[model samples]
Target: MNNKTSSFLWNFRQLKLNICPFGSTSIRRLMKVDPLKLHKSKITYQSNSLQKPQSSVRNFCQGVLAFQLEGNEIQKRSLSTLTSTSVGKLLNPRPLSFDSQCFLMSNTTPQLAEDGLKKITDSVEHDLSPKEKQLDFGKQRDLIQQCNSMSDVLDVFSKYPRFSCCNYFITMWKIAKNMSEDQKRVERQLLYEHPAFKQLCDHVMKEAKIVRLQQLMFTLYAVIRIGIPQNIYLVQVLLRVVQERINECDETSLSVLSRTLETMEESKNVDALRAALRLLVDKQIWTIEHILTLQTMMKCIGKDAPYPLKKKMELKALKELNKFSHVNSQYMFGALAALNHRSLILLNECSKMVVANIHGCPFWMLMNILQSCRKLQYQNLDLFTAIGDYVTTTFDMWKMKQVLAFLFAFETLRFRHIGLMNMFLKRVLDESQSLNQKEILCILHIYSSLNHFHECKNQEFLEVITSALNTYLPKISSLNLLKAVYCFCLLKHFPQDPFNQLLQENIINELLMSGNESSKAENMLHQVNACLEFEDTSVLQSIPITLKECSSDSFFSNVEVEDVLLNLFENKRLFLKNVQLPHNYFVDFELRMDSKRSQVFPVSEADVFVAKPDILRVALLCVPRSAFCFGTTHPRGGLGMKMRHLKALGFHVILVHTWEIKRLDMNPAVTFLKTQIFSQEAFPTATEFAA
Candidate 1:
């Protein structure tokens, strides 16, 4: 395509995107002018369809996207140029134009500014909470919106002493958001020393007691969007005020406020936010009426939100899923993400919705659905194949972190579509220069987890990761470094010369002394040592950490399931309980039989290890509900790996998921076990023994 035609077609792609500011209004092709040279190229709106009733015409800038005013609302539209720079970079973030307090909810959404903030809607404007309803003074909002300069903003607040905290907040954001970054950062500067900012903070703090729910919510939000210029006092005050009036917040305001808290990077503020949000969820969750409100509540609860709160939300979400047809696709997707995968019914219902809406989901949303599937351990290849077909074509729009997340999810689910894997790996290779410490761990983990030991496909990435890790070794977390070493062992491609830096005294001690990971770290040490012994090519003079001798006994997470299985074996001598194996692997029960495998007899869990019982071992793994992913019956990566190693060591595995015991009576559970142990599928290896 020629440069002119290419630029013209780019407009079509933008118009096609639902997130685009122009809607369907951009590609009407009302008029086309001859291309002017370089930056002079422009598209002017001449048609009445582009104009608002009783409003003046608005023209778009030639090379940048700008917001247009129509009626009482501000709308986003397009103007394009085939410039040297890309269209996304050419656009600038629109200034604050909220009818409510959504601005703070999206600043940390991992999107560039131009994505969605340009078009604010009026739907979320809360009815002023009961206490502040009397302070809705006349014409204040209109006059403030009309102000064109900072001086005008200051003058309005000065004129109206009765104006509520809402007006005060609007003025603060208008003035402070426009200030350039350099002005805010210097140690001692005129902007920092200015009294106007201090005055704004003082007024908000003064009126905080009677501040409308709207203003308080947005006040907390604005601190996240653009921190108060030299005003930490305002943040601390806002937090204190939140605890007092937190229950006064309506459902939508509460959701927005909770989302804004996730963007707070400071640990101190995060702890406070978690405490408040958790308390509020406990108090208000029972009273929520609207389904969309529930959806917002589910979406706002971040990964760090209380665990019991997450369980409560999932129970509420599953009840709300019957109303899924009435919900928006985005809201449904968001609610579906919070579901615990223990319910196949929920996963099945949600997957139907997912497949139906798969083609319409954007790049990030699709990737999020996949990540949720990974977490849920939902390994329906049909769902994955459908998403893979769509996302593989729109690969260019994916951000680096999203790409890393998508690849990691694919590997975790153990669903290796050849084309999808190739596309993700190629993107990683193309963007290798930008990999950070965590990203390098992700890349290496994806590579090894998928068992991509091929020298040709994985060689370049390993070389890049090795060079990157050597630089990033000290920077990576102790947990992640251990995971990376485990990945190295999985691939058997550890670069001896560079990664020997992993065995440094300080690093080894950090790995050994990982507090919460003390038990797991011992397993990692054994894994690395086993790999080192097998490879027989050590750059290190000796193994770094000494292994402590211990019993190889595996314990059951759900002991009730074991009791049920024990009843099935009527003869206690027929089942060996909790046999621990090499490399931290454990089977709940093991049985040994003759080589012909005619009859099974119980061997002592200890005595079986004296001989090669893995050859005739009929291993029964009692996977708890938590061991499976959120919705599917499939075991998660960790348990699946244990089962895989058991099979590789010559055991014919018999599986028992917790649902079998939970959903079935003792008779049926016994029947299920007999079928699993006695009549195996023709292709047992091809089953979901790994996933």
Candidate 2:
């Protein structure tokens, strides 16, 4: 028979002997008397075995014999010890009386066996015992009956050394799961009810044996999964356990610990991990010391070992070492530099070291470090040389990928890395043929962020950017075309003439036609245009001349700009009701007379000269002024004092400032003279004017 069959048969025999102690002998005889009759006898034996226990083996034998004698086709058979062990044990040290056994055996019945089996099955199914059901219904009575204190639970769990094993863990889990609602409430209360439970849990966690430590780790995982408040303590206990296990050189323990650490990572429980690390450090755990020693050992292993094994060892060492300090600022740079120099041959080893160590530091901290480093080595040719050497050497794609991401991040924040940034950009652009859309987008985004378009204005760089765009533009998907357009537009006006004609002929028109409505891109576009002195005169003329294009449709479509301006004006009106004119408006404009106009006309019917007479008749408004001063060479034949001298010329002269007099406050003809002046000559220098 197969092992599975053998095991099943063995368990079945044990059960039979336990319930049918007195009937064995008679059943054996029935098996022998008529071998064909043994089948019915076995069925009868099974039926009786399912109920209450028989009183004695002799009584069971008598009952079976009586049944056989009644022509029940009894089959006598030898009693196998396989089916008799349980009954034999229970019947040991019995009274030496055959009659007592016979009475007990005769009384055994299938009904009693059935009832007994049902009780046992019910007990297992409901997790209820007769004693438990008899307990009180009130809260105080319930608490008094059960013992589910935190300390008690910990004590129970601490006794099991093989807690990490599946079987032991499942059992304990069932026990906890079986607790009533009241019991669970008591459990929680006991946990935080007093300082004693805390002390006990702490002690148990610290002093837990190896197997118990494994169990503790599982428990911590469970607690974390359940989102229990006790996770803080659990984390502390698990970290200590890991430290101990690592020191012991227990591979199994390390495996479990590694998985737990990864779990913590996946859950983003950095705070808990930090707390655990701090506890280990403050306690001076031997595991950390051992880890440091192992790192030294790996260094001693040098480069001669097999690459895979060496990588594994080195990675293990780095992971442990990472727990010693913040990864990004403390360890990541050195690790990256080492890999860059070829001192680290394995890319996986380098990646693990970098990822593990770097992630420990805050993102802002990493950003700060990168920024500071970028500025320090920005113009250094050696840095670029090193990067190029590293990127080209070994062809390690993983390291290259990480470096690219890192550089992208640095550039994204507009950190200074001039020499390396330029080199990297050149390299990437050169390899653009092989790059995917996502990779291209990342590069373009970083380029945009660093304002690298400004550098593209140089003749040499302009060709490169133009070439890249020409090659990639058609390949770029429609969704990303808008982004590429913005980047290209930025480059078009980057203050150089290498591509000036190309921009004016094609790129500018493309941008104007594309009509993207992104406010951010538009704003940036406008800034670029203003920086390069590109004026969108059509949009400007629509607004009041007194308002300057502080920011306007140069960055947006006419409709979008108008909507935004309307909203802005609405908000301004609501928030700044009393604020003054030009200060209140977002844009400001200054007006001046054309320098080339030798003669100017007043706003009158005669002065309204039509450039397009067939189009429409226009009227000009006029106002009277006080004084007009003419140049010494002026010829005489003027009809009247020309308003050009009164208003167009820059001078202070007196004029009557008028408004309608109302409310009977003053005489209607009382006119006040306001001194205003005009001059054709240029304003004096500061010194002359002051004098």
Candidate 3:
């Protein structure tokens, strides 16, 4: 035979000789019979060879059945339920007496010994416990009771899972949140690792409806402090409950509810804010904090508050006006502006009160009040004078933002507090380092507006501005850079050398990458206004120079003004193409009038001054849609000063517009202007006609 066939036959013969060859080793051991009995029976079997194999198989099956029955009995009597004495005896099998040993040896088979070994191993494994929870019962209870911070509570929960289900979860968090900052910081670290704390917060939120009002507030306070995830449904549920029981809430409870309402995301459930506002206002027990909350709510609700509700709120403010301090009055004014409510009566009284206490008012509070006045477009000379005097005397104490706000409001009102401006210039010299990028832009904007009346020739102010530009230009945002450059052009203030190069590069980049075309044109005009000899003109190619290109730049530049005048003259129906002109035709035409001779002086200008009459000047204006109401109506500002100067010059000025002519028929508007200018009866009483 070949080697492979020989090897296979030998392996097959060895396998056939082994006992219980079909099953695994353990199974075979359980089924095995005693070898001594089998050997003894072998001789007998040889004598009766035909019945031997069948008789051996029958004996092996009986042995397996007996072992299975004994294993079943052991399982029924589990090791956990057995007493310690039973376990000890089972493990040691108390040194069997001579008679017992002899009986066990005579009956036991290999299958019985294997079953006994399996029972011992199973009992030992089942008796062992986890080491994490090895503490005694009293010690576990004590650890839980003494828990103070999140660390203590979460640690106890880790050891004993049952402690996580206790009723004191909310109470423990309350104590934890009130701990020291250091302790809380440590606890916060632990809170992130354990997920069961989040589960506890969820449990408290779900059970909030059943808790007392104080406890509910406490729960919210703790959750907010712990920085738990905000639940919108829970907030809605709390709001509903508070609304139902609003009458039962005292001042303290109301305050807590208002704070909680403020903490919620404003875009979700704005109705809750409105409801809180109505409740607080109805109570009429106003505190400083309540007023602040009202301001926040007004901002959230905006102009959507009902008219009747607004009137009621106005009445409440008036009723409580006398009790308000400077800060409260400031808040009340700001709230009125945010809600877009007009209360001139309250404003008059509030101003008088504010003037009385102007010296003692905080700088921030005074600034807030001025911001409100600006919003209302109100011009109270006495209030302005008082605040101006205080700011002028104590200019050193004001911050840069405060100074900027004062300048904006004062300039808007046409209140040229000269002492204030001088003090402001001097103070800026000392506080230049404190000026930031935003303040720089504000300064430029105010200076641009003021330059309309007089030139900005203050050297120190210019120097401070140039210094700030050099320090912060690289970090400024693109849009703000455009605005800053525009303001600088208007004020004729440009940075020097390397900073100028950087500004040019940024402007070029912005223009090239600009997505909006209209904004680009408007920015281009400002760039042209700030024309330095060194500005890079390459970026100007992208923008088409056109008038009225953007709707936002409503106030026209010189070029736009000229274009508008040209468009008006081109309309042939007006019949004014052949009128005579003076030697110098100017945009800012000064008229000094008298029956004998004209008294010329520096004064207001007509937008398109065609002819300066001794008693009648025909002036054309292109006022923006917004300026007619809020912008030009300041008492001593642009519109007011123009009217006063026109009257002082003894000129009957005729106002004409080309933009609004589209709304009216061109023929009738032309007829109206012609009649007023040509008819001698039009100036019967030296009248100024505005068309």
Candidate 4:
């Protein structure tokens, strides 16, 4: 108890030095609590003779003035009566890891050993529980894995209350992670919330002296997988354990530790552990032989890793990639994903390798590979098709996350399997309740990108999603909300009454007013685009923000195709360039047909354009290469929406593929234009004269 208390004071004093070290803010944070309680405290301080840097004569005596310490019965005596740091340095203290003890001191020693750390049972001993006597560590681990339900596992725990710290930790973690998908989230939540789990955490806190490093590391990993580790007390203990004993960690442990701290980037507590992990990994990086550990280190450190470290890692990868291609599919996937579009040539070559040898890979790894290829935006048709086939045949085996990831890849890839999407739609609707916000958004993004608003069956899917989204709408970020609205508006449809109610004038005004410049501009654009699509002028009447007219409409003219067609038009009166239509659409060339179905003329020829409402209005669209799928003439979902929107606005939309003008000679282009403008059955009025 004394050693742990001294350790806490020492750490708090160290924190005081680094935190502010000098300013008035220094001591204020440690005692920013109720003034009434300070008056009621029994103990008082006396100034120390020493004049340290941040610790003033009075500040040096601070232990705790009884806010939480009073609750714990910790303020029994004054700090003036407490022993000096030099006297307390004689007591051995608990360390961040096992097999080492870093005692409380004013300063720490430099560069330590890299010996592996595991559990070291303390001197304290107690009689074993009957269940502990029956089930050894291996048996306990096996029982935890074999148990079907949380209650069964609790039965095991209730029987054997005491095991080695590491054994107890593994037992709890295995129980937490091993559950059916239907019960996975619910059961894990219940497990963490259970009294047993709370007791486990409390036991660790009370028995910090005896707990091992692996126990702390695995506890953190379990919480990350199970739920958010919001308990600052528990987290601080684990981090300090690592910080004080970091030098004793092997490269393997450091690699794992880096991966853990990677997620806690927001906390200041893990900074020391993170720095220690980096320093150790930098020296030991070359000795790493396991590909996945190396990949994990690179992934966790990411671009922040030193240039020398990154350069050596890449160089090492370059040698191992060739061997990984033939031996391990997972290694190949990691290699390609880690590179992440650095070399397009390698991306394509590795994609070809995946296509040739993807059959043996697991479904989880295969999903990652597919997502990696999609991320690189370099799709090999065979690779996507092969995996799609494999997933379709074994669709029942894939989890919802895997399905969501697979569908998300469709946003850019030219590939689509109708049967796959159909199965996915049914799966999504049935599992809609289980879907989280991001997962639901991925589904909407995919379907919207495919222009599924026109599909009847997708309506119910949207409804389920809309209902689900409305419940969690306020909790979602601005980017996701905008994305949701964009998906619905792009598809020319939206959701239920509640979702519609959120678009009330005041709500929209608040969104625009409260957000950043980019968010405000984007929200305004969505409002403008939505007004154009649905013709809801009421929503636009009093909008707090306005986007530029051009910003509201994403489309721009394809200059190459437009120029070719403009040169073909003998008279500028025949067509207009950059014409704006009713629904925020930009027509590259707008031509009209006369009453006799013979002549084509620009709107300038019309004395009153509204009078000839019966006449055919043509939107001569110049579709750019980027608007289509790579290596194919198939239009992407966004381009399809444009053409659909034009048709909705009552235009006889005509598409001129950019490649036709860019790739072909003038004579061939002229022939193509003639066929496009005047049908074989129609009288050639402008086509004949233009030729």
What is the lDDT of every predicted structure here? 0.58, 0.35, 0.49, 0.56
Clash counts for all predictions = 5, 41, 2, 1
- Model 1, 1-691: lDDT tens digits are 5544554455356444412234245433322211111133234445646453122122222323323334334344444422232222212212212221111121123254333222111111222344544546657777688775444555666665445645655555566576676643441243234445456556676566555776787777765564543225466567656644554678767776766665565444345455556555655777776676666656555555556677776677677666665234434544545534244666667767777777657666776667776665566767777776666777677677876666677766665555665677777677777777777887777766655443356677667667777776656676777788777666556676434666666777787787888788878777676556545445655545677755743365556666665777677787777676665566777777666555777676456766563347677777666665334554544555555566666677777766677888878877776666666351147345533
The candidate that wins on lDDT is 1
Q: Could you tell me which residue pairs clash in candidate 1? A: 341-630, 341-631, 342-630, 376-629, 376-630
What is the lDDT ranking, best to worst?
A: 1, 4, 3, 2
**Candidate 3 per-residue C-alpha lDDT over 319-398 given as tens digits, one digit per residue, 9 for 90 to 100:** 66666776666677777876678789988887887888788688777777777787887778788888889987787687
Q: Which portions of model 3 miss their true places by more than 4 Å?
A: 1-203, 210-229, 232-237, 243-247, 250-252, 267-302, 325-327, 375-379, 401-417, 431-436, 452-457, 471-481, 493-513, 520-691
Residue 290, candidate 2: how far off, in angstroms? 5.1
The TM-score leader among the candidates is 1
Worst 10 residues of 4 by lDDT: 97-106
Candidate 3's displacement at residue 394, Å, is: 2.7
10 residues in a row with least lDDT, candidate 2:
631-640
Per-model TM-score versus the true fold: 0.55, 0.29, 0.50, 0.55
lDDT of 1: 0.58
Cα displacement (Å) at residue 484, model 2: 2.8
TM-score for candidate 1, please give it.
0.55
